[model samples]
Target chain A: MKSASPLPVVFAAFFRAGLRAKRTRVFILLALVPLLLTLLVRVVDPKESGDFFTKVMLSLYFQLLVPVLALFFGSSIVNDELDGKTLVYLTTVPVRRRAVLLGKYLAALLLAALLVAGGFLLCFLVAAFGRLGEAAAWGELGVFLGAALLALFCYSALFTALGAFMKKSILAGIFFVFGWESVVQYFPGVTQKFTVIHWIKSLLPIPPGEGGFLIFQLQPSPPLPSVLVPLAAGALFLWLAVLIFERKEYILSDNA
Target chain B: MSTVLRAEKLSKWYGNILGISDINLEVAGGITGLLGPNGAGKSTFLKIAAGQLKPKIGRLTVFGEPVWGNPGLFRRVGFCPEHDSAYNEMSGGAFILLLARLHGFAGAEATERTDKALAAVGLLESRGRAIKAYSFGMRQRLRLASAILHEPEMLLLDEPLRGVDPLWRIRIMQLIKDYGRQGRTVIVSSHILSEIEAMTSEIVLIHQGKIFAKGDIHSIRGLIDSHPHQVSIRCPQPRRLAGQLVAGEFVSGIEFAADGGGLTVRTDQRDRFFSALMPLAAQAGNEITEITSPDDNLQAVFDYLIGK
Candidate 1:
């Protein structure tokens, strides 16, 4: 038998398709919201732009947008195929199921990363326009981008596994983001560590007393563990997604 | 003949509803028409064979290996599903080319196969158009093109002719016949008996989650032909036509229309009855306006066979 097409071929085709997808367009608009907010704060009060940018990055970008964007992009990796009844085409190919899932997952991850990076870069440039020459300011931007990447990797992988496990994964993801992450991250001591946001929040360069109601009493974990936990968890979740996808028999139609 | 597909005591059920039950059969290469009515076990059996669904009980194997979770088997198998589904965003050529690439064809070879498959299905000119813009019949043909683009040893088509125009239907049927003639296994499923009958003489009759019968079409045709058939004839002189039909050896019984506009004739031999009715209606005195066999369809024949 002929060898199946390489993983790059599947990744390239799906990546191009993912860019044109309607969901990606919606995400592009969603990612732009932070940039718009940064611009508005910069114009109204230039002195407070730096501080507002930090708050926006923490509450909106990291806590809300990153996880939600990952949820949309990552869950759709499997859900979209099932909904469109296009899974048959992918499953029937000579390639292994793991290759198909990983190829699509990589496409979704890249697409989500582009959205977050584009929006974050613009928001950072607008907020730190006056401080561009300073090394410390550039370092802070790098840290934020690094934290955002880690948060996205962790969240997207988690949601991708959820999508493979259940059909109505968006509902479950919404609850995890709002109900579990929102409430659990604020809990004192070790309990907050259970939520993914705790590790993400620890990586952010937020001063102890500055985040108001969102992170006033937040006990951030050490930077190393924070970064390591998300990386390890993301890898675990991604492996789970592949495991479920390969073994599970998805019924394309009404059992026919 | 070497067995291409085998199902040993295979059964599948979705909760309370049974799909196929205890289906033990072996299919050899050449066209085997899966003849059944709607909601019969035909689609279920095909889906299991295609590796789309796992059997709830027993096993189904294609080319001696289990089909479920066997992506490698697809290298030798092509399946056109029953649902009218496609990536509406992609052009017909693009869709076929993607499947070609997935099947391991690269560069010019993928494009060539795509071109050939599209041309075979008469979609070559409109290959660049998005599938959504095409009519239902066009999409059906596109699905057929996708399945054949790989040129696998076995083709499993589930209601492939559905929504196809009459002109293309004959062409598609001929294409399937050519595949059979080339010594490949082509299993085409359809609810219509004449559709399957026109394609191949070998058939498997499935109904209510079971294989009711399997053999040459002639045997099933014999059973249907022997069943009492009702022929309704509208005529100006119903009494005269009934009087003539009463003497025929094929006429088992006759009933006059309550409206006095037509007569319903029961015949044991439908072909002979039709032959006798033609001459009577052609006579100068007899004026037959219309003639229809009410139970001439396969559904009625199935109902009689299954004692439904």
Candidate 2:
């Protein structure tokens, strides 16, 4: 019998469910944080609004918010099912395990993208108030948005693979985001390249040395490598997630 | 009948603890009850057959294909897991619909299959309600609906009737019977002897991760009847009843309850003992109020068979 393609089916089902999830509600509110802060900057000091958007706002979204969102969404792609004991439902279907992982990954990625893009757009509008009409300002907004998507793609895939491999991957994911990404990104030379945030921050419009130590410090990688690194890493992580999901034997209950 | 599922020397374990060990079984069409106490490897065995877990040592196949990593084999197999789990946010209709779509149905066909499955389990009216709002029984029925939604030829149900109300229990039993009548392969697991007895006479008694017995109920019961059985009888005159019953050949020993209101009788021939006791009790002033076999449960049966 010719079976319907499982990827689209799983994607649609999980996407609709994720939209109504309580986590999504909290994220919608969390995504508003950057927009709210940009509004504060616009109100407090109109003259440095653009500078704040480029240096501080970009750092906040790229370094903190985007990766955090990706971590939660991507890791949850498999972790939620494991904890909930709902992986059986997905696995028992006449669909490949890879399809299930990829479908849920896509659904999660889309949700994360929407949240980051929506907040970034609102923040961009407020920070670039008068210069909104200029192509340069819009062009900057496009670059930041592109970088945010790439970051989410790469980080979420890594987390998804971690989740598929281990039950308590979120703990490790938090350490990576707050610990490794935070500490390693500031190590001056080649060490910063070890972090995913390095490739992401390299793509930002804000030049290095402008945003102090917390933001970018050294020369960014060439634009081609910046885009390719995250893309290639994301693909590799996603492939790993699919491999782990397909082969791993999950023990759902302690009922022996 | 051709075999639908086969496990060859299949074994699995969690750490040092065993799940199922060296299990070799072949099942054909019709209902076969997996009878065992909790943690007897029923769920573990079913999970392996359903492709939820890979066997540590050996192989399991459905439709001549390895169950693990064989998704297409599910097109002819259905599994209702023991755990009470579902996406709480999604409505029942949506959940079943998603599974139907996964089975390759689309558009109006998927909708029809979903509705038919819901209706079969008597959840059609509650289809729009969120699964979290469902009672334990309703969730169970919903899980049943999910399994049968695709109308697979082989069905594996792990404690499907658990937490279901009496009314729904009978309905679900009838539904399972209907599945068997259609010549479909159904392997239903339960710790309750009568529950399995009610569904099918063919049973595989599993204990401590091994199959203790496999046959019709009559044959297994014959093996069990030979074991010494304790029958607790509550009577007004326990000493008098014990005196009248102690002389029988089937009566092995007798113990008086601490309360002095009941007598426990150990009988080598349970059927013969009951036959003699019925006439003796009806005679006069023997007035037996209650008669219960504490060891009637599957656990006690396993213990007796294993010489515990």
Candidate 3:
């Protein structure tokens, strides 16, 4: 028997929905926040801006903005379907539920990436002003973007998994962002490596030729494990998200 | 006829709440009205049949194959949900066309079908409008368009006529009737008895998720007829009218109004009593001013049937 693929259909449906969604505007604003801060840092102190770029901007991007974006974008992917009760269209189709989840996940990830990466590029431009020819400047920007993308994938997948498995996932997502990730990423020793932000901060090029802090006190991790851990963890979380979304039955309304 | 849909002792529950219980039914092609008051298992049963939910007990099948999680079956089945929800961002035409394409139509065929469906539902002119801008009735019609655009053999419509204007209501009803006449299966649900009566004689009366009655309308009427109906009439000659009505074989009892202007007549035969009352009121000497039935109210009728 011939089976239809659901991925493209789900992707298209979400893409069209996201285009006209009011929330996209808010996401755009969120993506611009980092650039605004970077601009402020640059304007206030033009020449002595290296420390601000390495410590403050890096801390803000890795420790704060990325996970918050992931939390909002990922959770909304499933929660939106439940809220609008539009999930019936996808659920009733001949497609497996996993296809529906994964498709929506891809769309959400893409949208989040555009916002985060777009913001990161703008901030990178401001932070690296007048350093166009320097290898260190371009390298810093590349590493920051790479780390931000990985953080988005890992955090979004974790939250997406939570969304698939729970109804009030937003509350749990908030706690994970503010309570767990914020607190866990700061713990000293190997335990800090368990948090996604640790891997992200480890890959940055700033605070170069480091002692403990980069340029100031921004510590970087060993390169390979930093890259590999978040990637593997993200894939694992994404797999869990697909599994739960496929199996869980979501009741949008009270039945007779 | 081959049983296109079947359920055997099917039951579903949510925690301590009963979603639907002990439903056994078999249906084939043509229109079948699932009639019940609000909160009756009509929506639940249809949702399960549409493969939106799983039955906790027994089984449900369409085309002799189990329906849950079966996407292949959707090629032949379409559903219009009761809730008024759509991709409000998309243009109405795009929504319908999207569904048509999902059903595997290609190129010009999908566009043709989408146009035909919009035209059928009186939405062709508003096809370019965002669904959010459409009125409730227009949205209702849009939902209908989506369901029919795929040209599924079986369409499950939950309150498909809801929020629709009268003319469109009749037209939409006719469209559904026409689908049935074409040998396609349609299960339409509504809380209004007369609405279902007007759509199809074949009905399944569901109450609290249980299939209470399933057969021709006359059979269900027979079950209800045994429960006497109270018809109140106000006229200048109230006592005189009551005297005349009590003699009928259908009238089980009659009571003259204490206000001296009406009479309440109880009859086990609603049709026969109405048939006789028409001519009696038209007689030259008849001075009947008003006629009403407390039992004619749907809630009272439902209560009487449940033997409350």
Candidate 4:
């Protein structure tokens, strides 16, 4: 039976499952990825903490850990069921497949948000430690955190859509992360706009005229376009997730 | 009896393999045994009826509504799938409660329903532990509990008794019969003939993706009884046994095994053949050690029916 409004139930199920995850322990080490870079920057040149902070956020959070974390959480929303053979419980229930996809997608988004948010906050504290109550410092932190959240939502939704569409979406997601998003975000002109990280990097407080390996190498789109495109595209991707999940006929056993 | 399920030209196939071929059937309210050998399209038929799979050729309706992808029909239906699966992370109690809540039961009533189902299946004591910690038999019973917890009107059980203990098996069978008494429909599938026989008389025999027969067990039994019966008798005095057995009018053919080992008799009238064998063997110096029916299995009966 097709259930009415099954998304909430699916979300709650995934939320509970995520809470029970032992991966929270692993997340501590992951959160340290950005923190470790900050520690290295302070020991080398304590005066250039802000410059190093932007570099650290781009290299660690945006380039590596953010997308990696989103991939793990989002892909597992559907992949966990297919792998564990536990999707039968949800599929057999009269709930709409959209609700199942969205609910689990929300759960993955929240977990990814929590992980990135925690890491983002810690990196800020370490970078600007003892630079208390500076409006400019806090403003830059807000932009960075906001960009990270938007990036997480967009990338995680993309991965979740990939998961709903295919069983072997993990390999594809890894390729997108290492091959596409990582490589394309650095390309000059409009090509960088094609990557989620490009828009994310645009929203950062780094001025366009700044000279660095990232700035001189990659010319980003305007900040407004960067933010709106991924957001709009994320919603579209999420919609496609619901569409595919609702229509897909997932066979639980070896069909006779 | 009211018709609980109706299928019209229902068929399903996966790739080159036929899951279940063209089938038209009506099931009235009671325990209806769906008997078939392994890979005989039993699970496929059940999945279609339970709304798990779509029909490739025709239609299947549970209580008049098309079952596939229809969640509203779930209010009246409960399906216990053949696959050994459960949310292993949730405790037995939590799993039952989740289904009950899904059915819109409130806090106290949901708890009551969950408790009743667990107690009914004798899993109340293990309610606190995770399902993954459960034994295979307990998980099977837990699956049953989840199905019944919502008090669904039509229960579809695919191999419900697999890996169940004898005592619980009897209890579950009784519970099914009780549901039937309440006028709810229950369709149970199993390879075990005696298991199906004990639950209810009405049955649907499926063989190799086709409906071989659909009727009561006795009616099917009559078919087997009417078939040329083969009885083997291993005795010390084979000549004496054959002498008494061949004299009967029902005994059409008889042969003694090589080395004068045992007697094999084919007869149209099994009752008369047995009745004649008893008296002749009872006489002085008549020694009978073993007797067996190799054709007692449903498959053998089905094969005979098809061959005929």
Give me the candidate number with maximum lDDT.
2
Angstrom error of the Cα, residue A209, model 3: value is 9.6
lDDT (CA) for every model shown? 0.86, 0.89, 0.80, 0.79
- Tens digits of lDDT, candidate 2, B1-308: 99999999999999999999999999999999998888899999999999999999999998889999889898899999999999999999999999999999988899999999999999999999999999988999999999999999999999898877545766898999999999999999988665677799999989999998887888777767777777777788999999889878899999999998989999878878877887876767777765655535457778877883
Better of 1 and 4 by TM-score: 1
Candidate with the greatest DockQ versus the true structure: 2
Q: Estimate each model's TM-score.
A: 0.87, 0.88, 0.84, 0.82
Q: Which segments of model 1 are wrong by more than 4 Å?
A: A1-4, B225-298
The C-alpha interface RMSD of every prediction is: 2.2, 1.4, 3.1, 4.3
Q: Could you say which candidate leads in TM-score?
A: 2
Per-residue lDDT over B4-43 for candidate 1, one digit per residue giving the tens place of the 0 to 100 score: 9999999998889889899999999999999877778899
Share of reference contacts found in each model = 0.51, 0.83, 0.44, 0.18
Q: Rank all candidate structures by their lDDT, best first, as comma-separated numbers.
A: 2, 1, 3, 4
Q: Candidate 4: where are CA atoms >4 Å away?
A: A1-6, A23-28, A40-50, A209-211, A214-216, B222-305
The root-mean-square deviation over C-alpha atoms between each candidate and the true structure, in angstroms, is 7.0, 6.8, 7.4, 8.7
- In order, the B-chain TM-scores come to 0.78, 0.78, 0.77, 0.76
Model 1 chain B is weakest, by summed lDDT over 10 consecutive residues, at B289-298
- Candidate number with the higher DockQ (1 or 4): 1
TM-score value, chain A, candidate 1 = 0.95
lDDT of 4 by residue, B1-308 (tens): 76789999999988888999999999988889998877789999998887778899999988888987787788788888877777778888987877776665656887898999999999999999999999888999998987888788999999888877555777899999999889899999987665688799999999999999888789767666777767676777788777877667898878888878778888787667666766665566765644534435446667888887
- Candidates 2 and 3 compared: the better one by TM-score is 2
Interface RMSD of 3: 3.1
TM-score of 3: 0.84
Query: For model 3 chain B, where is the 10-residue window of minimal lDDT?
Result: B290-299
